[model samples]
Target chain A: MSSVRLLVGTRKGGFVLTSDGKRQDWKVEGPFFAGWEIYHMKGSPVDPDRIWASQSSGWSGQVLQRSDDGGKTWNVAGNKFLYEGEAGTHQWYDGTPHPWEFKRVWHLEPSLSCADTVYAGVEDAAMFKTTDGGTTWNELPGLRKHGTGKDWQPGAGGMCLHSIVIDPTDEQRMFIAISAAGAFRTDDGGGTWKPINKGLHSKYIPNPTAEVGHCVHHIAMHPSKPKTLFMQKHWDVMRTDDAGENWSKVSGNLPTDFGFVIDVHAHEPETIFVVPIKSDSEHFPMEGQLKVFRSKTGGNEWEPLSRGLPQKDCYVNVLRDAMSVDRMDECGIYFGTTGGQVYASPDGGENWQAIVRDLPAVLSVEVQTLP
Target chain B: MVRVELPAHLCRLAGVGHEVTVAVDASPVTIAAVLEVLEHDYPALEGTIREHETKQRRAWLRFFVCEEDWSHIGMDAVLPPAIVSGKQPLLVIGAIAGG
Candidate 1:
C-alpha cells in the first residue's frame, strides 16, 4: 500500500497534507517557513531525500533554501543578491539604488541528472544554474546573450521567470518559460534557446506570435511522454506534442482560458489538471464560480470537478505555483488560491474537497510522498 | 532626523504612544539603525521584528519610508534623503497572515 502526502506552499509559509491509501482522511501540518512568501517548493524528483524552496520577504528580499532531511531543517545558499547594492559590490543593472535590493528567486528546481545541480528562475527574468548544490551559480549563456540587460521590462508582477521543465529521461533537453517572454527550449542544455511561441495568444499584441507579450504562466509535462506538454499561457491554454515546435488551443471546454497553473498526472500521461479564471474583467473565476478542470485524455477534453467545493459565490485566483500533482500512484491533485483557500482532489480531480480555508494567499504547492 | 510611527501592534510593544524619532544624517538610512532605535526605545519590539532563534527579520513585518517600501532595503544601508528630512514617516506595517 503506497501512501501519499501533499506539500503546499503559500505566501506566509507551507503545509503538508498527509493521507492514508484510502484518501478519505487528511492531516494538515504547518505553516513551514512561516511568514515568508514561499513561491515554490519540491522534493527532488530524482532524490526524494533532498528538498528545495524559494522564499521572498516582501521587503526583506528573497532567499533560496534547501533541506536535505526533508522539511525538518533548512540552510541558505550562496551570497544574497540584493535589488540594490553598495558603491562597488554590485547593483541592479538598472541603477535603482535602495537600502537593500536583490533579485527574487521565484522558482527553484534540482536537476534530474545531478543531485547537486540546481536551477533558479529569478524575478529579473534571468535563469541561474548551480552544479555544486547551490554553493555557487552562473547565469545561463542563452539568457545572457538575449542581453535584455538592465532594461528587462517587468510585467504586472515584474519580469518573473516562473517555470523550468527538464526532460527527466534526457537531462540535456530543457524547457524554460518566462512571464512576458513566452516559452523557450534548448536541446543542448543551456547552450542555445529558441522562442517556441508559434500558436500562443497575447492580449497585448495584435500578432501574438511575433510579439514578446505571449506570457506563459506555467508548463506541465506528461511523465511518460517527453515530447507532450501543456502550458497555461497568459490568455489561453495550449498543448504541444512536438516538444513545443507548435502549440494549439485546448481550452475549448473551460469557462475561461486565463489561469496561472496546470499539472499532469504522475503516472497517467494523458491526464492533466488546471484552474480556470475569467479574463478581461477582474481576473476572477467566471461568474465567481471556482472550478478545477481535468482532462484525462490530454487536452482534447475537460470536465469541471468540484463535488465537495463551496456552493456560494467564490472568486479566487490560483497562482502559477499553487497547484500540483503528488508522486503517488493515484496522484492526489492539490491547489491553493489568492483567497487563502486550498482544495484537494484525491482521485486526480474525479472529486474535490477543501482541506484548509482562510490561510493567506497561496503562492505554490508541491507534494512528496514520504518514505 | 526623521520620525517613525509604529503600527499599533509595534507601538504597544514599544510602549510609546506618539512616534519615535531617530537621528539619521545620511540620504539613505540603514535598516540596522532604525531597528536599533526601535529596539532601544521599546526592547520588546526587537524580538517580534526578528526571529528569536536566527535573529533574521520576521516575515510578517514590513518597513516603509514615506510611500516607498523599505522592506527590501539592506539592514546596514543608509536611509534615503526624503525619509531623513521628515518628508515621510518611517512606517512599519504588519502583514496579515492565514487563509
Candidate 2:
C-alpha cells in the first residue's frame, strides 16, 4: 500500500500532512518556521525524503530552506541572488521604469531525476538553479537577457515568474509563465528562449493581442501529454495544442472564467480543475457559492464539484499556487483557500473533505505519493 | 559566553527559548564576531540577521545593547564593556512596521 504526504505552505508557517493509502485520517505535523510566510514547499518526485521551501517576510526578506529527512529537520540554503551581468529595469504598474529588484521567490521546481538539482522562480521575474542541492544558486540569466526584459511590466501582483513546467519526456525543454508578461519557452534548456503567448489576449493591457503582456495566473500540463497545456488567464480558460505556439479560449460554458489556479488529473490527462472567482475586483466565489469546476473534455465545458464543499454563503477564494493532485491508484485532489481550509477529495473531486479546517491562510499546496 | 536576546520569531527559528547564550571565541569580541558565531552555531539562521554575501545588517533589523541602537555602528567596532562582560545582553530587534 502506498502512502501520501501533503506539503502545505501557508502565510504563517509550513505543515506536513500524512496519511495511509486510505487517506481518510491524517496526522498534521507543523507550523515549522512559525511567523514567516511560507510561500511554497515541494518534495522531490524522485527522492521522497528531500524537500525545499521558500520562506519570506516583510521585515526579514527572503530565505531558502531544505529538508533531507522529510520534514523532520530543515537547513537554510544560500540566499545570495545576484544578476549575472548588467541588471536592468522593467516597466512599473504605471508604465514607468522600475529597477528590477528581488522581492521574493514564488515557486521552486526540483529536477525530476536528481533531488539535489532545483529551479527557483522569483519575483521581479527571473529563474535560478541550484545544482548542489540548495546550498548555492546561480541565475540562468539567458531567461531575462534573451530580450523583452525592459518591455515586461508588472501586474497588480508584481512581476513574478510563478510557474515553471519541465517536459516529462525531454529534459532540455521547459516552459515558464510570468504574470503580465505572458508565457515563454526554452527548448534549449534555459540557454535560449522565446515568448509563446500567440493566442492569449488580455483586456487589461494596451494591446490585447500583443506578443507579450498577459496576466497568466497558472499553466498546467499532464505529464503524459507534454505538448498540450491548459492555462488560467486573467479572464479566460485556455488550451494550447502545439506546446504554447498558439492558444485558444476554452472558457466554454464556465459561469465566469476569472480564476487563479488550473490543474490536470493524475490518471485522466484530459480532465482538469479550476475554481472560478467572481472577478478580478471581487476575489470571492461566484454568488457566494464555493465550487470546483471540472472539465472532462479539457476545456469549453465545465461542471461544478460541490458535494462536500460549502455552496451557501461561502465566500472564500483559492490562490494560484494553492491547488494540487496526488498520484495514486485512485486519483486524489487537494486545494487550500484564503479562508485557511485545506479540502481533500480522495476520490477525484466526487466527495470532498477538509483535511485541516483551520491554519493560517494557505499560500501553496503540493502532494507526494510514497511507494 | 555572551548572553544575547533574540526576537520571538528568531527564537522559534533557532529552537531556543526567549534568550540564548552565544559562544564568542575571538579575543576583544566585536559585534561582527558575535554574529559570525551565532550563524555558525545555528545553521537555521545563516543569513537571518545579516546578509551572507555582503555581510551588511538587514535594513529593517537593528542591533542594540543596553537600550542604545548599535545597528548603524560599524560591525568591526568593539561592543560596550557591559555587553562584552555579559552584564548586558546584546539584543537583535526587528523594527516595528506601520502602526
Candidate 3:
C-alpha cells in the first residue's frame, strides 16, 4: 500500500500527518517538543522510516534528534556545530568584515542512498555532514573556505545555508545555496566548492550580476534531470540548465516575482511551483489575494492555482523552506504559511484543503511518499 | 543525596518528575556533581541546560539553592549543607527572557 507522511515544522513545534495514499482522511500526530522552534524536519528518501529534526530553543540552544522508527521515538544526536579552524569572517552589512558565528541549524537533508548519512545546513552559513546517523557532525569546510567567502554578506535573514540539492546521478557532486551569498557547487563530495551565480542579477547589490551576494530564497531540482535547477530568488524566479553554471530569468508571467519557497513536481522535471509575494519589502500576497503560480512549461508562462486557496484579504508569507511535493503517481503539493495554515493539494495544485488551520506559524514543510 | 528541580520544559524533556533526587557520589557535593549525574541519567539534556564543550551554564538558565542565586558561583564550589543533604532541592530554572 502506498501512503504519505507530511512533516510540518513550525515556530512552536513539529507535527506529523499521515494518510493511506488516498490523500483523504489524515491522522494528525503531534506538537512534538512543544514550544520549541522546529526549524526543519525531513525523512530519508532511501529509508522512509528514518527521520531527522532540528529542534532549538532560546533557553536550551540547538539539538538534533534522529528517529529511526518514523518518529515513534527520537534520540537526541550531536548539537555541537563547531566551525573548523578560525571560522573566518564575511562582509558585514556595513561592508566591513565580521567574524562568522554559529546559529541554529536551518535545515536537515538526509542522504538519498543511505539512511544514516545526512547533511545539516546552519546559519551564519556553513555546511556539515554526519555519516553515523547524526551522532556527530563534521564540518565540510571547503564551502566556506572558497576564496570569495569573505565577500559574502548576510541578508535580513542572517546568512543561512538554507537550500541543499544532492546530485542523484553523480555521488560526488552536490549543490548548496546561501542567502546573500548566492549558490555554490561541489564536484568532489563537499571537499571543495565554487560559487555558481554567474547569470544572476541583483539590483540591490553593488554589481547586478556579481558571482555571489545574491539573496537566493530557495532552489529545487528534479531527480530525473539533476542538471536543470529552478530557483526562487529574493526577486526573480530563475532556472539553471548547466547545473547552476549559468542562470536565466524565469519569472515569466508571475504577478510578483519577489517571494520565498520554490519546488519542482515530483515526476515533472520542467513543471515547477512558486508562491509569489507582493515584493521583498511587503512580504504578503499581491492585491490581498493568495495564488500559487504554476509553470508547466518550466517558466515564462504561469497560471494561478487558487481553486481552494484564499483569494481575498489573505496576507501570509511562505518562508523559504515551507514548500514541498510528494512522489505518488498522482503527485501532491503541500505548503505552510506564516499565518499558521498548512494547505495540501492531493492532485497537483488543482484544488487545496487545509490539513490544519491553526498550528503555530510554520517554518518548514516536508512530505515523504511512502510505499 | 542532592535533591534537584528542573524547569518545566526540561522536566518534560528529561521525563522526570518535578523533583529528582540523585546520589551525589561524594560528600560536600557541588553543583557540578549534581549536573554530571543529571546528564548521565538523562542524556537528552546533554547540551540543553549547559554547554557540551565549555560546560558553561546556558545564558538563559539559572541555578539556585536555599533561595540564593548560585548561578554566579563556580560549578565546583561546594553546596550548602541543606542542599547537600536533600533538605533543599537545588533549582535549575530557565531564566525568564521577557522584557
Candidate 4:
C-alpha cells in the first residue's frame, strides 16, 4: 500500500503529516525547527526520504536544512547566499534604483530526476540552486542580470521569486515567477531567459500591460503537458497554450478573479483548481464564505466545490505557495490557509477535510506520494 | 580559556549548552578573537551571531562583558582583564524585541 507524506511550512515552524493510502486518520508530527519561520519544505521526487526546508528568522537571517532520513532528523545545510558578480540594483517602490538584497527563501523545488539538486526562489528576487544536497548554494546570475531587472519593482510582499516550474519533458527548460516583476522562462537550463508575461494586464501599475512590471501572484503547470500553463494573477485567472509566448484570460465564470493559488489535477492536464478571494484590498473570501472552484475544461467555466468547506464566516487567505496536488491513484489535492488550517481532498475536490487545525499560519505546503 | 553564554535559540542551533568555553591563544585577546574561536568550534554558529560578509553583530543581538554593553564597542578592542582571566563570561543576548 502507498502512503502520503505532507511537508508543511508555517510561520512558527514545520510539520510533517503522514497517512496510509486510505488518506484518512493522519498522524501529525512536529513543530520541527520550532519558533523559526519555515518558508518552504519539499521532498525530492526521485528520493522521498530526501527533504529540504528553508528555516529563517528576522533576528538571524536564513538557515537551510536537509533531512535524509525523512523528517525524523535534520541537519543545518549552508546558509550563505552571496550574489555572483557585483550585486546590482532593482526598482524601488518610488521608482528609484535599490540595491539587490538577500532575504528569506520563498520556495524550494527539488529536481525531478536528482534528489541532490534543488532550486530556491528567494526574496529580493533571485534564483539559487544546490546541486549537492544542500551543502552549498550558487546563484544562477543570468536571470537577475537579464535586461529589465532594474525595472522589476517590489510588491506588497517584498519582491520575491516565489514560483518555480520545471519542465518535465525537457530538463533544460524551466519557468520562474516573481511578484511585481512577472514571469520568465529559461531555455538553456537557467543560463538565458525571456519574459513571458504577454496579455497580463494590471491596472495598478503605471502601464497596464508592461513587459516586466506585472505582479503575477502564482503559476502552475501540469507535468504531462509542459506547454500548457495556468496562472492566477493579482486579479485575473489566465492560461497559456503556446508555452507562454502569449496568454489569454480564461477566468470564465469565476465569481472574482482575485486569487493566490492555482493548481492542475494529477492525471488530467485540463482540469484545474483555484480559491477565489474578494479583491486585492480585501484578501478574504467573498461574503466570508470559503470555497474551492474547479474547472474541468481548463479555465473558462468554474464550479464551486463547497462540500465540507466553510460556507459562512470563514476569513482565511490562501498564500501563493500554499497549494499542492499529490499523484495518488485517486489524485489528492491539498492547500493551507493563513488561518492555520490545512485542508485535504482525498478524492479530488469533491469533498474536503482538515488535516490539522490551529497551526501557526501555514506558509507553504508540499506533498509526496510514496510507495 | 574564556567562558561564554549564548542565547537559548543559538545554543540549540550550535548544539551546545547555555554556557561554553573557548580557548583564545592570541597575544591580545579581543572580542573578535573570542568569536573567531567560538565560530570555529561550532561552525553552525557562523552566520547567526554576526553577518558572514560584514562580521558585524546582528541587529537583534547584543554583546555584554560582566553587564557592560560591549556590543557597540569595536570588535578589535582588547577584552577586559576579568573577561580575559575567565572570571566573567561573555554574554551573547537576543534583544528584548518582537513577540
Candidate 5:
C-alpha cells in the first residue's frame, strides 16, 4: 500500500501531513525548517527520493534546501545571490547600487525531466537556476536584460518571476511568468526567450504585446497536451492552445475570474482547477466565500467544490504555489489559505475537507506519493 | 529597556493568559535569554517557542519592538532603556498570512 504525503509550507514554518492512500486519517508533523519562511516545497516527480524547498528570512535573503528521506530532515544546498561582492573590488557600481539584492524566495520549480535541475524566483524580480541539485546556481541572464521601462512596473511583491513551467518531454522548452512582465518562453533552452503575451491585457501598456509585463499571476500546463496552457491574470483567466502564441478569455462562468493559483490534472489534461477570489478589492473570496472550481474541458466551464469547507463567512486568499494536484490514478487536490487552513479533495475537486486548520499562513503546498 | 506585548498564541505558550514582562539589560539581547526567562517562568511554551528539532528560533515567529521589526537585530544587541524599564512590552507576533 502506497502512502501520500503533503508538504505544507507556511509563513512561519513547514508541516508534513501524512496519511494512508485513502487520506482518511492524517498525521501532521512539523514545523520543519522551523525558523525559515518556506515559500515553495516540491517532491520531484521524476525522482520521488528527491525533495526540494525554497526558504527565506527577514534578514537572510533566500536559501534552497533538499531532502532525500522525505521530510524527516533537510539540508541547505546553495548560497544566496547577494548584490555586494567580496571586500573592496567595488562598493557601489553607479550612483545607484546594483540590483541583484534580493530579500526572499517567492517560488521554486523543480524541472520535471531532471532531478537536480531547479528554478527559483525571488524578490526584486530575479530568477535563478540550479542544475547541480541546487549546490550551485546561475542567474537567468535573459530575464535580467529585459528592460523594465516605465510601462513595466513592479507590484506589491516586486517584479518577480512567480511562475516557471518547463515541458516534461522537451527540457529545452520552458515558460516563465513575471508579476508585471507578462509571460516569456524559450524553445532552445535559456539561449533566448520570446514574449508570448498576445491578446492579454496589461493596464500599464498602451498596446499589450503577447511578449511582456501584463500582470500575470500564475500559469498551468496540461499533462498530455504540451501546448495547452492556462494562466490566471489580474483580471481574467485565459488559455492558449498554440503554445502561448495567442490567448483568449475563458472565465466568463466563474464567480470572479481574479485568482492567484491555477492547476491542471496530472493525468487528465482537460481537467483543470482554480480558486476564484473577488478581484479589484484586496483579492479576497466573494463575500468571504471560498470555493475551488474545476473545469473539465479546459476553462470553458467550471463547477464549484466546497462541500466540507468552513460554513462561516470565510474570506481566505490562496497564493500561487498554494494549491496542487497529487500525481495518482485518483488524483487528490490540496490547497492552503492565508487564513492558515489546508483543504484536500481526494476525488480531484468533487468534494473537499479541511485536513489541518489554524496552523499558520500557508505559503505553498506540495504532494508526493511514497511507493 | 523597551517593552513588548505578546499575542494570544505566544501568551498561551508562555503559560500566562495575559502579557508578561521581561528585562533586557545589555545591547543585542539574545533570543536565548528571552526564551530562557519565558521557559523558566511559563514552562508551557518551552517546546513551541523554539524549534522542535534544533531548539532555535522558528523562522515564522517574529519579534517586534513597538512598530519596528526586530528580526535583523543581533541576539546581543541591547534593548532600549524603556524596554528594560518595562515602559513598553516587546511584541512577539506570529507573522500573518492569507493573500
Candidate 6:
C-alpha cells in the first residue's frame, strides 16, 4: 500500500507525520531541531526523501537544514542571504523610510522537476533560490527592486513574501505574494516581475485600488489548471482565471470571508477549501466553533465541513501556510491549527480527524504522497 | 587555547558540548579573534552569534567574562587576564527574555 508523509513546521520545531493511504493510523517523528522556530519545511517533488527546513530564532537568526535520508537526519545548509546590490529602503510602519534588512524565511517551495533546486520566500519581503540543493541561496532581486517597493508597507505580520507558486506547465513563469504588497508575477524566470493585482481592493491602504499595497494572506493553484488561482486576502476570498491578470471576489455565502488559508483540491480543480475565522481583529472561528468551508463550484457557493471538527467552544486559528493536500486517488486534505492540532480529511473535506494534538502551534504543513 | 561556554541552543547547533576550546592567533586575544576561530571551526555557527556581513553581535545574545557583562564591550578589546589565561571560560548566553 502507498503512504503519505506530512512535514509540519511549528513555533517550537518541526515534526514528520507518516501514515498509510487509509490516512487513519499515523506515526509521529519529531520536534526535530527542538526548541527552535521552524517556519517551513518542504520535500522535493522528484525526490521525496530530500527535505529542507527553515530553522530560526530571535537570538540566533536563521539556519537552513537539509535532510537527504528523508527526515532521519539533517545537516545545516547555507543561511547567508545577501541582496544582489545595495539594500534599499521601504516604508516603515510609521510611513518613514526604513532600510531593508534580512529577516527570517517564511516559506519554501521545492522545484517541480529538480530535487536540488528550491525557492525561499523571506521577510522584509524578498525571493531567493538555491539550485545546488540547499548549499547556497541567491536573491532574484527584480521582485524587490520594483518601482513601487518603497510604497509597500507591512501588514499585521511583517512585510514577508509568504506565498510562492510555480507554473507547472511553463517552467519560466512564477507567482509570489507579499503581505500588504499584493501579488507579483515573473515570466522570465525571476529576471523580472510585475504586480498582478489589477482587481484587488483593500480598504486599509490609502488607495484601495492602487498598483500594489494589498495584504494577500495566501494563494493556491492546482497543477492541472495553473492559470486559475485562489487567494485568501486580508479580508476577502478571491479567484482569478487569467493567471492573476485580474481577480474577483468569490467569498459569497461564507459566514465570514476573513481568514488565512486557501487551497485547491487535488483531483477536482474547481473544488477548494478555506477556514473562515471571525475577522481580522478576532482571529478565531465564528461563535468559538472551528469549521472548514468547502466550495465545490470554486467560490460564490460554500458549505461548512464540521463533522469530526470542534463544533463549540473551539477558538484555534489556522495560519496561512498551515493547510495542504496529498495527490491521492481520494485526495486527502490536511491542516494544522494554532492550538496544536493537525487535522486530516482522507476523503476531501467531508470528514476530519486530528492526527496529532498538543504538539505546538503549527506554522506550516506540507504533504507528500509516496508510491 | 581558550575555553568558551555556549548557550544550550548554540551548543546543540554546533554539535558541541557546553564548553569547547579554540586556539586564537590574534595578539592579546580579543573577543572578535576568538569568535573568528570559533566560526571557522564550526561553520554551522557562522551567522548565529554574529551577523554574516555586519559582524555585529546578535541583540538577544550576551557575552560574559568573570561575572561581568561583556556584551557591549568592544569586540577588539583584550580579554580579561582570567579569561586569557584559561582560568575562566568566556560565556555566551541568551539574554533573559520571552514569556
Backbone clash numbers for all candidates listed? 25, 0, 0, 1, 41, 1
Better of 3 and 6 by TM-score: 6
lDDT of 3 by residue, A1-371 (tens): 79999999998889998998878788898898888899999999888888999998889989887888998887788888888898889999999999998878999988889888999999889999999888889999999889889999999989999999999999678889999999899999899998999899999999999998999999999989989999999999999999998899999878889999999999888899999999878999998888899999999999999989988899999999999999999889999999999999999899998888999999999998888
TM-score of the second chain, each candidate in turn, equals: 0.76, 0.93, 0.94, 0.96, 0.72, 0.96
Q: Over the full model, what C-alpha lDDT does candidate 6 score relative to the true structure?
A: 0.94
Error of 3 at A304 (Å): 0.7
Q: Is candidate 2 or candidate 6 better by DockQ?
A: 6
Candidate maximizing lDDT:
6
Model 2 per-residue lDDT at A305: 95
In angstroms and one decimal each, the interface RMSD of every candidate reads: 9.6, 1.9, 1.2, 0.9, 11.0, 0.5
lDDT, each prediction: 0.72, 0.89, 0.91, 0.92, 0.74, 0.94
Error of 1 at A237 (Å): 1.0
User: What does each candidate score in C-alpha RMSD?
Assistant: 8.3, 2.0, 1.6, 1.2, 8.9, 0.8
- The numbered model that scores best in DockQ is 6
lDDT of 6 by residue, B1-99 (tens): 889999999999999999999988789899999999999999999999999998999999989989999888878889987887889999999988888
Q: Model 5 scores what on Cα lDDT?
A: 0.74
For model 6, the superposed segments whose C-alpha errors exceed 4 Å read none
Q: Order of candidates by lDDT, top first?
A: 6, 4, 3, 2, 5, 1
What's the residue-level lDDT of B64 in candidate 2? 92
Stretches > 4 Å off in candidate 2:
B21-30, B73-78
Give the C-alpha miss distance for residue A332 in model 4, angstroms: 0.8
Tens-digit per-residue lDDT, B1-99, candidate 1: 678877654454345775788775444466676676666665445445654334566677887766877777756667776766767777777776443
Give the 10-residue window scoring lowest on summed lDDT in candidate 5 chain A: A86-95
For model 4, what is the alpha-carbon lDDT of residue A57? 85
Task: In angstroms, give how far residue A149 of model 6 lies from its true place.
Answer: 0.5
Preferred candidate (lDDT higher): 3 or 4 = 4
Error of 2 at B45 (Å): 2.5
Off by over 4 Å in 3: B26-28
DockQ, ranked from best to worst = 6, 3, 4, 2, 1, 5
User: How big an interface RMSD has model 3?
Assistant: 1.2
Those runs of model 4 whose alpha carbons end farther than 4 Å from true positions after fitting are: none
